[model samples]
Target: MADETDEPDSAAHPFTRLTPDLVMDATESVGFQCDARILELNSYENRVYQIGIEDDEPVIGKFYRPERWTESQILEEHTYTQLLADSDISAVPPLIIDGSTLHEFDGYRFSLSPRRGGRAPAVDDLNTLEVLGSHIGRIHAVAGDGGFTYRPLFGLQEFGLDARDAVVAAGYIPAELMPAFDSLYDGILADLAALFERVSVNTLRLHGDCHMGNVLWRDDLPHFVDFDDARSGPAIQDLWMMLSGEREQQQNQMMHILRGYRQFNHFNLAELQLIEGMRALRMIHHVAWIARRWDDPAFPRAFPFFDSERFWSEHLLSLKEQWARLSEPAIEIYD
Candidate 1:
């Protein structure tokens, strides 16, 4: 595992500040006996623990990465919770501690919230897709109406994944792996500029990172998590996230979301068909992110291409596919 503490403020994003032993002791101090083991859940910048009590319900304990210096994850959670509630969108509620607020443990900030109920659905799962679409509709409604209003905090990376850092992250790959990473990374950057010029939607509070894996299907209910990547700007910015893992056949996921989203939202006629181009740009971002998080536990795994030739050829194929649809397009009509 690459050092999760490799960022600038190494002390802040400590992986073990709130250890399982510490959690057991804390709960015990509060008169609850945590009987079950604390299992580790993956996250790129934070630590999540699945804690189960004998007679009570299972819960999740989240330790915000100490390295979260730029953005206030806690404040973002606090605000997004209330905003989602006002929008009637259910989300992970912030845990309260000592009647004040949930934050780093003493000097150590951490929080405990309800664990997601069931299994994480595959990207193309229909039911989960509907859940994602509906919830996103609600979010768009809120954001478009000026309901979700707050600025995000940034570390060194201006956004959760900086466009320029895309290249720097490629440095992680060994020299032997250099050519392959370069070919994929360069194509993605080009795709970024192309998509930025093509798509349009309301500049609302987007989920920022919206791929299928970011959600869970618990007892048939779909739940979304992780706001560390949140940012402002074009709503279609989320198109990248929604299509992140659906590379094999992203159309199904895109269409499934369109089916549900169109019910509550409207785009200029041209904007609707541009979904393909928008999603193509999203794929580029996803691929670059995959390269960046090569050692990141929470991000997607590496592409399965055999070599640089295959990867570049794949990018060319996707570019051609995207351009084919770009000719007759949906232009953005912002609110």
Candidate 2:
């Protein structure tokens, strides 16, 4: 399993200063009496914990990565989730404390949420996929008008063009492997740009990162957590990651999902064409994410494979495979 945990290595990382006592105190500062039982959750970009309360259920404390988001950008995410919750969507919005959702204590910005618990959904189950699709459809229905004013857009410039530049500048690629890396990357980017130009998609506020890892399965439904990556983008950005397995299997999965999806919002057939391109962008952006954060001690520990030539070599091959996938006809959705 990948080291998704984000525990920092002492003062070498910003979160090094976020001690257990501080975590409990931060929880208490928000009006809850801590029982001194704080368990760190699995997260990398930010530190999250489940804190026990004196006479109540435990609550979640999410300490935002310092300087990663401005107050406005964070609040916009809060408001978007609130919109979804208001529409009967199963979204975990932060608790409103002292008339505000955003709070700060001891130089750290954090928010408290009622702790939600569930196991990851069985993505292969057709019923589960259908249920997941309905929830996402409802989310998009509510999100149609609540476009974020401060959040970023999921697009080529940030995820593709800038990502390509960052990895090259990070100097992680072996000098000998640079040519293969450059050729594959440049071709992928050019194709991605042309693909984006070809498909005119309707962008809206989205969960931004809606893979199975961020979803919790309870009450036979999908509850979306971590709108941290929430941003304005095409609706498909929220849907594609749920798909897995071979081509026919993924198509069957999409069929079930859209069966529930189209009941709420119109499913644009054109957006289907961008799935591979979107996948390519996510691939490139993910590596760039690791590269940009390499300076953070925890990142190296979690992604040790990244330090090796074998990793880059495998990454290039994966990119080559994805590059070929981009040329194939988009997966067809049938009745």
Candidate 3:
């Protein structure tokens, strides 16, 4: 008999039903015999685990968050990854069982993938950045094929405006800092909108959350993972997150990345202007994401600093910094 406390309160979280037994049962239902070893992976938006197989190597299981994305959207992501694999890109794709990449078990949607291992890419290394850039360029070449019919688009409304509204509605802003935050946030959004208007960039399907954490480096090569945030957006959306440091350092880094990026796909110099705008949107959207997921038990444990007066104060100050950068010229790369 399971202890009452051992059972998650479904009313509080959708994952309450995802007990260990349920995880094993779901894997077995999909025809994979479990060795009863389940190691939870580091994932917040979805429930991911490394489940041991009866007589084989371990496999990764990812259970989608209920209602976060429709079936079509998830499948589109799976299909996109499959396409990338077909192109010989080192991308991990979901295992197809019964001709479907997605499966349903006990009302939860999930997928299994072979476990891939590697350390985080060296973002500070120019050579590594260039290699990552080439990988992204190849990805964009495939993405430029057409727009996603079911997936969402990345823009101010989705990343900025909607995020700001959600944060305000959630009342996460500290009472004392609300006034300053409101003014700074609004000004940032307005400037971001104006910056977007000044640039003419085409939107293509992108590896929506391309950060060092998502890319694994092995043998000096990069393998992209987690296309869950995949959507249509500016190419710069995938490029900006890889950069760090002073303006000059970022510019030098951009030159290296573009050198490799231009090999497979056309490098749009004009999109360079949207880098800061994209960065600002990500900043706002990230906070809103944390706020929206605050109810999840894992969130509080992982992000104990969030919602504190100090956190919000620092966050507001960072917003001010981003606001200032938004007014400055976009990063320029020279030969």
Model 3 off-target regions past 4 Å? 1-11
Q: Candidate 1 local accuracy as lDDT? A: 0.55
TM-score of 1: 0.66
lDDT tens digits, residue span 188-299, model 2: 9999999999998888899999999999999888889999999998888999998998888888998898988888887787888888999999899999999888767778
lDDT of each: 0.55, 0.88, 0.88
Clashing pairs in 2: none
Pick the winner on lDDT between candidates 1 and 2. 2
Alpha carbon RMSD to native, model 3: 4.1
TM-scores vs. true structure, each candidate: 0.66, 0.95, 0.95
Q: Where does candidate 3 clash, by residue pair?
A: none
Candidate 2 accuracy as TM-score:
0.95
Predicted structure 3: lDDT: 0.88
How many residue-pair clashes does candidate 2 contain?
0
lDDT of 1 by residue, 1-335 (tens): 12433433323433534667777665554445798588887665566778877788877776665544333445665667657766776656655556633644445556667666656665557555656666677667665733234555211134213633663455433355456545654554455455545544455666666665666666665666765566655545555355534334455665676566666665333344445555555555555555544443333232444123455456556655655554553433233
Instruction: Give the range where candidate 2 is weakest over 10 consecutive residues by summed lDDT.
Output: 1-10
Backbone atom clashes (below 3 Å) for every candidate: 14, 0, 0
